[model samples]
Target: MPSTVFDIPTWVNPKVAPDRHVQIAKALYSVPGDLIGQRLSARVDAQTVKLYFRGELIKVHPRIAAGRRQTDPADLPSELTAYAMRDLNTLQRRAESHGTHIGIYTAAVLEHPLPWTKMRQVYRLLGLVRRHGADIVDDACRRSLDAEVVDVGVIDRMLARGATGQQLTLLPPPAPSRFVRSATDFAVRRPS
Candidate 1:
């Protein structure tokens, strides 16, 4: 028999959300990235919440009121911290690091009443820079911006089709085909 019996605490089995957080008592707490999608054991007390994975303690967070979230930056991927935090300045600076046009394009796309709503587009544009290369994406952004078009899909299509401004600038028009007809061939004469 134990020297003293412990008080029964409230427990919940919560699956980790994609954002690397689990909810307890309507409040959210961060969890290690590796634990995402896995159900965790959470013990709720008066002042703190304790989380367990397979009976091993994994995280601890102070109890917050319902409708609030407590995030420890360490739990998020380094590259995603700015995104999760909705820090537009950080995102814009990252775009600027790629090129002047990319930064301008990012700013254009994010110029919304609710700027945070466009964060995914800016993030996807950054991925395009990684996939196609900064020079190519920068040129595409320049062309799109010049045309007053602020669509990321258009920029991605331009990159996919290799139709960047520099490439277009260096290429000349194709020569007319030998099978082309002369203007006289289609000329109509009055019946005489």
Candidate 2:
């Protein structure tokens, strides 16, 4: 008796279902590419599989997409270009190794936020950090002293101790990452 090996479908085949395209799109977008206008073409032969990206072809094994699972973009980082490229490579390799076709579309470049908007966000975050700094300092002090002093009490104490504006820094400074998280989290956690 002869042993038999089963062959499965490749990702690049046009025969792949339409729902698979959606799954592929979700998986591809989870990586960091712009999905605007790129096209994917796949071809499979008996021993090797090929995938073409904008006419550039690569060879691989064919069973890459068949046995594996499709991932969602929402579960990945917003910038997923590198991940997408990796997936593409895997698919191509699988195709070539197993004699199947796999086509994957290229994505469009992503647009970054405007400079002014970014600056505004940074300033906003800095403001939040400054506002929260005193509270954080007060909390630390209280914890260190094993007391329950409020931030207002700390401010009052500082004033009573004749700590001038120059001697006691009361103003908050801008911190981009801190402010962004603080502001957003503050809003979300605020009671109605």
| Residues forming the 10-long window of minimal summed lDDT in candidate 2 | 102-111
**Considering summed lDDT, which 10 consecutive residues are worst modelled in model 1?**
163-172
Candidate 1, pairs of clashing residues: none
lDDT tens per residue, model 2, 1-192 = 548565553555222332222223122211112333434565544444554556665323332343354444443343342233244343333223322111110000011243232322222322332554434333333342344332334433444444333465587865577435555556656578
lDDT winner: 1
The per-model lDDT (C-alpha) reads 0.91, 0.35
Q: Give TM-scores for every candidate, taking all chains together and pairing residue i with residue i.
A: 0.69, 0.22
lDDT of 2: 0.35
Off by over 4 Å in 2: 1-37, 58-62, 65-192
Model 2, TM vs. native:
0.22
Cα displacement (Å) at residue 3, model 1: 26
